[model samples]
Target: MSEKLKVGITIGDVNGIGLEVIIKTLANNRILDFFTPIVYGNTKVASFHRKAIGITDFSFNVINSADQASEKRPNMINCWHEDVKIMLGESNSIGGKYAFLSLEKATDDLIQGKIDVLITAPINKHNIQQDEFNFPGHTEYIQSKTGSKDALMFMISEELKIGVVTGHIPVKEIAENITKETILAKLRLMHNSLKNDFWVQKPKIAVLGLNPHAGDNGLIGSEDQDIVIPAIEEANEMDVFAFGPYPADGFFASDNYKNFDGVLAMYHDQGLIPFKQLAFHNGVNFTAGLPVIRTSPDHGTGYDIAGKNIASEQSFKEAIFAAVHIAKRRKEQDDLLANPLKIRKLTKDRD
Candidate 1:
């Protein structure tokens, strides 16, 4: 508790509004109370943004590594060069290359334990893809880097958090791809994340049906009655609170989701649609089951309004806070596991 948590952040797509939101969020002095943020990006672009916004009090120090950064002042840990000197709203291949490099730097620092957590801004998916780098998004990139196969992507707000059984795959392919091993792994990952990252002692999870009306008990489809039901049975034996194959069309009809800690969507849009419907303004995209804490804003690069400065910093700020909160919980849990008696005294009386 004596030292501040070092949060390494990636400023994505300098041509987009990533820098704008990062500047706006960290400028608030209250953030210093929670984290010592080390921003991984270009120094020149950050300086240009500082001048454009007419802010003089904020200054960024360049560092080669996270340890070089001091908690006393916010730092811009320079990782790459600004590819092009382009306007804010314009798109360029140079900008994409720079953005990808910043993420690579941050990922390296994270793996080395030089930083406690990773918070990323939005990146242009199309612009950043090159012949050498062919990732669909940040989740896949992190998964490949960490060599983790059981990772799940969850979009979170205070009110709702939805994890995807399948993400970024074609809609037509989802049905064929849904399998028991995949569903079981997703459930276990979500359960462990809630317990370890969120400090939920007994996490409850809901599973959504792949077909309408839960396949009407196999009239419409047999996946819910066969695959999903068997998975839930296996989960029950493990003592994980998992229930469903709930009807996709009617799962959110009432307050059905409120009773569970997290929900597993059949596919991407099935879960994201409701989550964004409720918490788009301040939602966070969290990568569950990573060896380290990772989070980002739930939105994407707004190339249309990249320069207007109207991009809401709310989700970015929320992502930063979520990363901090999860990191703190993970630290606390680790400390408790290292010393069981301390945790017992701290939590035992909650009956």
Candidate 2:
């Protein structure tokens, strides 16, 4: 039988609820069946979060490498051994420093193929900024690391999947940054991801407009007509089933999102705001169109309820589930396409 897939996890911002959710999720032990999880973080810090949350029965098995990770136990790699203060619910530099440390180590193993998939916890983007990590967020940083030209910030849930044209930019700059070329790129990426990662064949993508009421048929803005519409047409020409510059406000309100395989919003908030409102506790932030698969919980560093243990781990658990399925789907797809010519010849011989 084949070995279980190795899932590399990063504990983001020790001061926040990163470890809390991770501990809670792994504590169940039932999750080890799908993938052997290798967490990149210090064991001491993990214990600190565990005690703070009053979880005494759970513990992580420390290992130095992915190969050393136990098949039955929850494993961890001690990325750092230095002593650090644990100020829960605080957004400080210490939190960001260690968050990067864990992420850096996990990313290295992922790139080296030691780990099959990656699941990152929430990080404080502002504090994590440094010489080594200066990108807007994890998606951009991973995109650069993999030498990928672009990556889509895909938000996935059981019922809905959404992607944005512009991410981590100022609201004023959104419209300016969006164009026909950018929209078409995201559409193509989203289409391929649905087929490759989620195994959706012939995916139909819904595109949202930049302005209200879909620019009121050009009464509000011209970008919907001049940029978005043309992009959708070009995507369709390329054999992608892309449709609509729907009004963002009414798309979710009237339950129109249920009909499509995926939705592409014009900007960050236009997509995320509605997604969070609907699936905040269990949504996953999947970075699509990259060589490697990466996913994280939809929520961010919960500074307000960090050590209180009130933060729910549902999103983190769901992220793990998504990562496992996506990794399996990708591997299966790769295996099937590895030697397509041989399979074609066999089919011809049968005929």
Candidate 3:
């Protein structure tokens, strides 16, 4: 209770708008009251990004480790000390190389319990692939790092919460990947996250149909009727109120997503396309079902607007706050679990 939550952050691609948005977010000292930020990136890169963004006053408190982070100011740890070329708005191997270094260091600190939560900046998915980091995206990478069995790409905002059964896979691979077991696993993950992290007492989840019009009741395709439907039926028995193999088109068009506590789409773009359209600037990409807390901005490496100071830091800021909130919720849940009899006694007395 004496210390603020420690947030470990990764500067995505040096060539992108990662550092720009991170600097902007940390510049606002008001957020320091909520959590202490420990950025795993070089001080030189941060300075370069700051100068390019035309910010003059803000500075990072250089620290050797996340444990030395100051609660009153934003902190930085140099993942790389060498002077890397700053080629803003360009995607190259250099960007990817350093991005991995920052991410790896932050992830180590996160897994080792030096930081309470992690907020990652956007990384170039293509260039940031090598022997050590050869995953589809951060969701899979973090899943592997933390040794979590399943990880759901949960896109969250004030109103909307959507998770996908299949993420960062090609369209052709989607149909084959969608199975009853996968859908059921995602349903269980989202349900538990809603209850424990978001504090939803009894979550009602909406499951979107894979094929058109839910396979037009077996007209278009039988995947929805055969796989998705069975998954929802089984989810009900598992204490998850999952319903609907509803037509994805009409579901978002009619604003039907508002009626449920959470929505589970069959694939990535199916859920994220609509979620981004609704809350692009503020949506937080949460990797649910992991033992550790992690979140990121809904947007990606903004090479198009890098160093222009035009990119909005809203989504990155939202991700930081979301991670902090979820950490607090999980801690409370842990305390309750540790003393179930006391919780029950208090509830009984109140009733």
Candidate 4:
């Protein structure tokens, strides 16, 4: 029998519901059959959250490193041994400090190939800011860490898959960022991600316009016609099977997004708002164009219900499963490529 894949998890803002959801998800012992879970967090922190959630039976196999992780039981690595205060439902500096520590440790292991995949919990983006981790979000941080030329914030679910052109940016700057070159570059990333990562052959991508009613042919704005349209045309010339500067409003409202394999929005909210509304609990935020596989729950830190035990673990669980599934598919694809089967023709003489 083959060994289980080591799924590394980073505990996001300790003050929030990061540990809560993680405990709830792994509480189901059956999940252990799929992959070996290695959590990068303190055992004391895990115990505190578990007790707060009233889950007394749950425990972790505490280890100092991933090599010591247990396949049958969930394992945890103590990123920090010092006793830290737990302020549930609040965003404090300590929470941010530990969050970065956990993330930094897990990512270091990921880059070194210690783990097969990484699933991060929610983080308070503002509070987690520091000199070493001064990025807009996890996508950019991981992109820089892995030295990936570009990274796509690929929001995925069973129903829809969306990618943003300009991620983690202000809405006012969206227009200026929507240039022909930028759109084409994002389209190329999405196109390649769909083909290579998701195993979709010849994916058909729908590009949404930057303005209302797709700029109404220069009525509301000219970006759709001037920038997005030409970028799509050039993408088609490159054999990307790209289409549209479709009006964002009616496109999703009228269910027109179902026709394409992927949708490329002009900015972050343009893509995520609709996606979250549709698949909030089940959606997985996959960071595409990275050398390593990374995913996170679609939702953020449930600060309102941090320790109330009301937070849902469905999305986090799905994120883990998605990571496992993608890793397996990628491995299979690599294996096939390494030892490709040769086709043999039968002729009359041979028969």
| lDDT, model 4 | 0.91
Q: List runs of model 4 lying over 4 Å from the truth.
A: 1-3, 342-351
In model 3, how many backbone clashes occur? 0
Q: Count the backbone clashes (under 3 Å) in each candidate.
A: 0, 0, 0, 0
Q: lDDT by residue for model 1 over 1-351, one digit each (tens)?
A: 335899989998887878878888888878888789899988788877666656668877777778788776778877755345857766778778888888999998888888988998888888889865688789988888888876899988889888999998888999898998889999999999989988788999999999998899899989998899899889989988899989966779887998889999989999998998889879999999999889999888777777676888999999988988888888888888999898778877774
Model 1 TM-score relative to the real fold: 0.95
TM-score of each predicted structure versus truth: 0.95, 0.96, 0.98, 0.96
In order, the Cα lDDT scores of the candidates are: 0.86, 0.92, 0.94, 0.91
The candidate maximizing TM-score is: 3
Q: What digit string (tens of lDDT, one per residue) describes model 2 on residues 1-351?
A: 145889999999988999999999999888888889899999999999999999989988999899898989999999989998988888889999999999999998999899988999999999999999999999999998999999899999987999999999999899999999999999999999999998886899999999999988899989999989999999999999998989998889999999999999988999999999988898999999998889999999999998898999999999998988888887777776897986577568879
Tell me the tens digit of each residue's lDDT in model 3 across 263-333. 99999999999999999898999999999999999998999999999999999999999999999989888
Error of 4 at 174 (Å): 1.1
Q: Write the per-residue lDDT of candidate 4 for residues 96-177, one digit (tens) a residue.
A: 9999999999999999989999999999999999999999999999999999888889999989999999999887888988
What are the clashing pairs of model 3? none
**TM-score (C-alpha) between model 3 and the true structure:** 0.98
Where does candidate 2 stray beyond 4 Å?
A: 339-351
Q: Which residue pairs clash in candidate 1?
A: none
